[model samples]
Target: MDPSQQKHFAVVDYVIFAVLLAASVAIGLYHALTGGRQRTTREFLMADRSMGCLPVSLSLIASFQSAVAIIGVPAEIYSNGTQYWFLGCAYILGLLIPAHVFIPVLYRLQLSSAYQYLELRFSKPVRVCGTLTFIFQMVIYMGVCVYTPAFALNAVTGFELWAAVLATGLVCTVYTTMGGLKAVIWTDVFQTLVMFAGQLAVIVVGVQQSGGLSEVWRKVQDGDRIAGLDLNPDPTERHTFWTLAVGGVFLMLSLYGVNQAQVQRYLSARSEKEAVRSCYMVFPSLQLALALSCVMGLVMFARYCGEDHHTSFLATSKKDAVVIFFVMDMLQGLPGLPGLFIACLFSAALSTISSALNSLATVTMEDLIKPYFPTMTESRATYLSKALAMSYGLLCLAMSYLTHLMGDSVLQVALKIFGMVGGPILGVFCLGLFFPCANSTGALAGLGTGLAVIFWVGLGSIVTRSSGSTPLPSSCVANRLAGNSTVILQAVYSNVTLSRPSGLKRFYSLSYMWYSGFSCSAVILMGLIVSFLTGPLKEEDVTPGTVYPLMGKLLCFLPEHLKKKLCCVTPLGQTISACQRQPPHQKENNGEAFHRNEELDSCLPEEVSLPLVEQETFV
Candidate 1:
């Protein structure tokens, strides 16, 4: 395998790839041309709230499963071992919390944007702050999403990077802007299948080419690529059981629980039950996605275990480029196979960016623009949404250039964005939902403090890495043909050292996995302390529908006397106490305490209108 030999795509490969792009465009055209109810803002932004659970479920999975995961996860497994797979553990509480806690509140409220809950619960300022934070997070993330696949493919296959970038970015923007949520969801469904098919094809072919499953497993085991549970309590130790499982919970919550990309899908479901069911469907699909990528990494390790391929190509490429190189190398004779894999990569990237563009347009129209222009016509609002989508699409192209300058692995960069920016936003939502005493002042304070702390730590870690920290020893030294090369084996053994980092550097060097958990905790703690100091929100001041019902039950565990101290009487002639004292009949109808009082309904702003279905009930 000469490194200089360029990988060429066959005519068949081009056709296969073209079909994927064409199918995406076709779906967009289908939605765009059929303009009955979809001409309105409601249908354009949220599919008229008529989406089924299946498409929404698949779209939710596609929202987060970007090319970063498809390529970066394998690279992580290949270089650092399979310890990163523990992220699966976090999905348990992750999906459950979103389904049970987030869905009911957000769905029942029937708001266009998830951040709109901030206005209902806290204040207009808090809502604006939340929307702005989300916009920043997604805009930055869209850059990474759009850049990763093109960057990797260019490194290995001589694909024009900027051309690929323009193709994906322009294609996604056009579809999302024209067809809106329906187009995004259906294209995601189509792309998700393509993504799975491509990965599955590569893995199956790679496994057969390398040997059997047992042979690959044996090779991985022999190379020490298999990892066990790392139960270490140290936060600085990266990819430990606690970090992936415990810390990952917060990461998942930030992405799934509060992120508008996912919340928009939840809101699009036809019913609350359908929304929850869609979340449940993500578990198996996501787990399968994780498993497929992990297996592909192990197989690549098996095939190239004793080869110095990194020296051949990886020296000039990103860590993620290694996966593309392996795929190209393995599928060399199989013409259409390479194209399928490349299509898979772009599919992952396109699904994610499309979702981001659509969701960004959604937040802009619903949270930012619509509020200012309350009397704007639906047609004008829909047009503005499309324009916003195009603007973000162009902005994404610019950010993709910035992503080229990034130094870390794509997985770490994406995760860092989720933690550094998303953690504080999640904290704000948590403050409103779980802690009734938190005020808008406390929410704003916590968010600012959280962002500052995370930026300090995140930036410090980047500095530490740039300052020549210890690097992982490469396993590429061994000779594949000779079974084992003693000299290269010795080099691998000698690279291991027992050095430890010290002081503030040690804290900054803490695992990137802990960033979300650490920042979320900091925000929550700071929010509670600031609220208590600056006069906590009264029971009457807290909005009814904004808080989760589970918070009340969780508070029931407190001592009876303590419950009495915390509970308060409301103007509705019902005791609005943390304690459960009222008879079943005396409780608010259907457990909807917020809607029982006409005064509370009056307090809701005129601009904060419910969906048509909910309006009939409320009116």
Candidate 2:
């Protein structure tokens, strides 16, 4: 209990941390030196997009499951309950849509940054708009990734939060900047093992400390602490069946599927089939991970529910320290246990940050930079890409500071930030893939309107949160008046009174799970109708052939019933045309087709064609 006391970092802790850092550096340098001409934009950006499934899939898992899943989930469950795990099923569903829909679209056309699709689908402005929004989303998310683990370490070891944030952030930036995606994936594979070890260790030891499964269950039920399965249909009531399942679907879909940070990993696979397999594998693994983490949380609360829960600095200090508390207290003398646990947390944290940095750089360099800096030199591009990587990392740091300063539930904060922009972004992608008739003008207007509408809907809730909005519903008003009993008059004046709690502030709040669903649906509906009015992009406007294949998938025209699965129908319904020519393109990228460097083309997805696959050259 010494306020001035410091938990000296054991030698093993230093050794483990040092080894992880050194290994990450070694991975980067090895790829840099050995990946022939890999130091160029071709190799640095994508690893040639010829990597097999295992490493790619593993990287995807490590990226998506960040330090948040490792540390944040347990912290959340320690306060709330396993209701959070209920959303994991929804997350799996959400993730599937992107894998099936967006990745296929990107593959057929071949795009380095998914943001480039925006330009091809709608117009140049739409591409820039989507890219900018994605940058914001990635920056905030990456910031959270950095902040969370540093926050966890600060809690256990007694260090300054800012210092910890900067230290880990700067080190993560080194490999990300130097090595790009190759460094990110190799390091992710390493971090994945450490993270799995750490999480499983805590779950094992915490369960043992809480007696055993039967005793733990008995204690939880005895304490009435098992908050499981509550199915209500109200969107206003955040954890309701509607919000968690539906809204959770949109949130996870946007995150794991369409998210550039997530998609970037999948595209690195040797083939589309391999990438699909990776995502399919992650679905069940995620549920198991969530179950384990939540079980550990229940055990922690069962063990130390009423202990003097004190934390030094995190804004939401109460439950935020739960995981760290459990580790430092319950997990005592296992030799190198703390070091392993810390590495696991950092691994999760850094893995996400690694993807964020590379994706941000990829998007900026490919989508944003190519537009404005047309004369982008490779050496300068690399230099600028690294600078942008650091810039986005720094931006996340600044935003994380503001997030802690404002005070928010970590889960709520993450969802809310993304929800603010996810709708329009998802809408743009959906329009590109599903609607053949959407043009640049329509897409732009639709994106703008969709964003404005969701802001008012979601952020408006915050107003009613502070002071009840005008014409508040009777149920809401009644709910407010019910709290009138808590009001009290000061001893000096019996008549002059005001409503209050022991501490009067915005205590009642909405859950954030519904944010993404609401925004996405709003945009889809609005964008579709708007596009219908504005007319579809002419063959000249958008690069042709992009829409036809995507439309075929949406309509189920690539006949799965046939042997080849590429059969077509004639105007005479009885006659199968047997023609699947992908609707002759009016030249997809014809203007500068010959001039564009074939070397850059080889690094792209289109380079992995049928004859090449038949040869099994890179696969």
Candidate 3:
């Protein structure tokens, strides 16, 4: 807190940070100058659909794992203990469902925008609505992502917040516009590595400086900072196993399953298997990222147990800045470490912002613009896409100011934004994919009702200022210094039992973690009801390849006639075989032979088929 304790960057530190920007730009320039030279929308928006699994998987991780996760996750662990780590449990289904379910459907459709499927299954209005909703979510989210590192750096170091924001935003925009999705994906690969390196450095140093891992463990244990499994069923109880593992699935679905940023990556993959493989690979990397963040927080707690190092930032209610403060305090004498961490922070931010800008451009051009102007030239479309990317990049800078006004923790804020907006999008996709009977009217009503309900809950939570359960105590220095290793302080200081809120206030008290699942359920439930009330869509009317036969497969144990009665659809295998029985000329005429590789079909489900009629019905 004193002037003497203020941390300053060394010459080498600045070099490292500068090099990060340079490398990112260089990557962009490389892609821009070579390989179609960003002259077509195919190259600009979808990377020519030739991306491999490795880069796509890494880019997928980099997409959502922004600066908020970099700094905010550590701050969360420092404040609330390791219970937040349980979110790692969510990644299993989060990545799996997207890999197996969402990827195959979207990939097979051979569509440019993920929302195109909305139009295919529902209507053009639903597609436009979904696209706008996604744009809204990403614009707001990228603002937070752009602001987080800059705000943190400005708080702990003397870095200019707006300058940093402008620098990252502009650099990201230039590269994203020039290089297209290839540059964005490859830069993401590089930046993701830097992100991991930065987090790892802090943990290695913090663990070493905090005596050793054992000592660090002892201090955290003594301070009661180690959280056990909390199995609370109360929806308002934040970070419990149920909320994290189960509720987290929907969160994952919202992001990985249906979010445009991730779906774009999936669509860019060379094949459906490659996309699925990339999603599978995300599991371990995500777990590692989660572990590093959680461990960094523990090490920080161990090093500064019972210390006032965090008080200055905590007093101002800048909980997000606490991690930056801890990093500065620990990395003071270390020369390049601080800069490397700063680079790590910005890399995370740039990766996210770039992905958002590109995807925003993709959806804007593909869903919102191209359909309305089907006769637009490719060159004109590419130019507009680049301009859209640049425009959105600039817009995110303005959005950062709005983020600055919010008081919630950055991680919570980011996840809540994902859930509140993304949940409904995921629900619409789910309604169409799993429920063939859900009509366009139902999809629209469901989407509207879901958005309205989630906004009410999300805004209510914000207005009520519903904080998480009491945090772990922040004092253990005396006991550690006095060689009292066995002493265990109470985890939380609260003793009074307060009465729970009732009615609307009780509903408002729901955990932010449950927002995705809760809102998604609202959409599905409302959608089915609305569909039945209005005439449910007949199986024959639903677009082929749009309905995934999820219900028929799930209810496969029933008699064939009974299954048909309930699911109201033909078996997937029968449908695929029936299509395969058609002659090559018939297949060509019908456009039902999108993939000719029998090997690839063996790898994916038989249900992964070409559209029976691609444009006529939908367009």
Which one wins on TM-score?
A: 3
lDDT of 3 at 399: 84
| lDDT agreement with native, every candidate | 0.79, 0.65, 0.81
Candidate structures ordered by lDDT, highest first: 3, 1, 2
Estimate, for each residue in 1-619, the C-alpha lDDT of model 3 and write its tens digit.
Answer: 3444456789999899999999999999999999999999888999988999999989998987888888878888887888888999999888878776787678776677888888767767788999999998888888888887888788777777789988898899999999999999999999999999999999999999999989998888888778899998999887899999999899889989888889999888887778888999899999999999999999988888866744455545476677888887788799999999999999999999999999999999887777767778889999999999999988998888777776545546655776699889999999999998887778989999999998888878767766456676787633344444444332222222345667787888898878888878888999999988877766766656677777776777898888878885553322343244222331211234322222222223444443445311211
TM-score of 3: 0.89
Task: Supply the global lDDT for candidate 1.
Answer: 0.79
In candidate 1, list every pair of residues with a backbone clash. 43-48
Model 3 residue 582 lDDT? Answer: 20
What residue runs in model 1 are displaced by over 4 Å at the alpha carbon?
1-3, 35-37, 405-415, 466-498, 555-564, 567-619
User: What is the Cα-based lDDT of residue 544 in candidate 3?
Assistant: 64
lDDT of 2 at 178: 72
Candidate 2's TM-score reads 0.79
In candidate 3, residue 504 scores what lDDT? 86
Using Cα atoms with residue i matched to residue i, what is each candidate's TM-score against the true structure?
A: 0.87, 0.79, 0.89
What is the total number of backbone clashes in candidate 2?
2
- As for lDDT, the candidate ahead, 1 or 3, is 3
Cα error, candidate 3, residue 499 (Å): 4.9
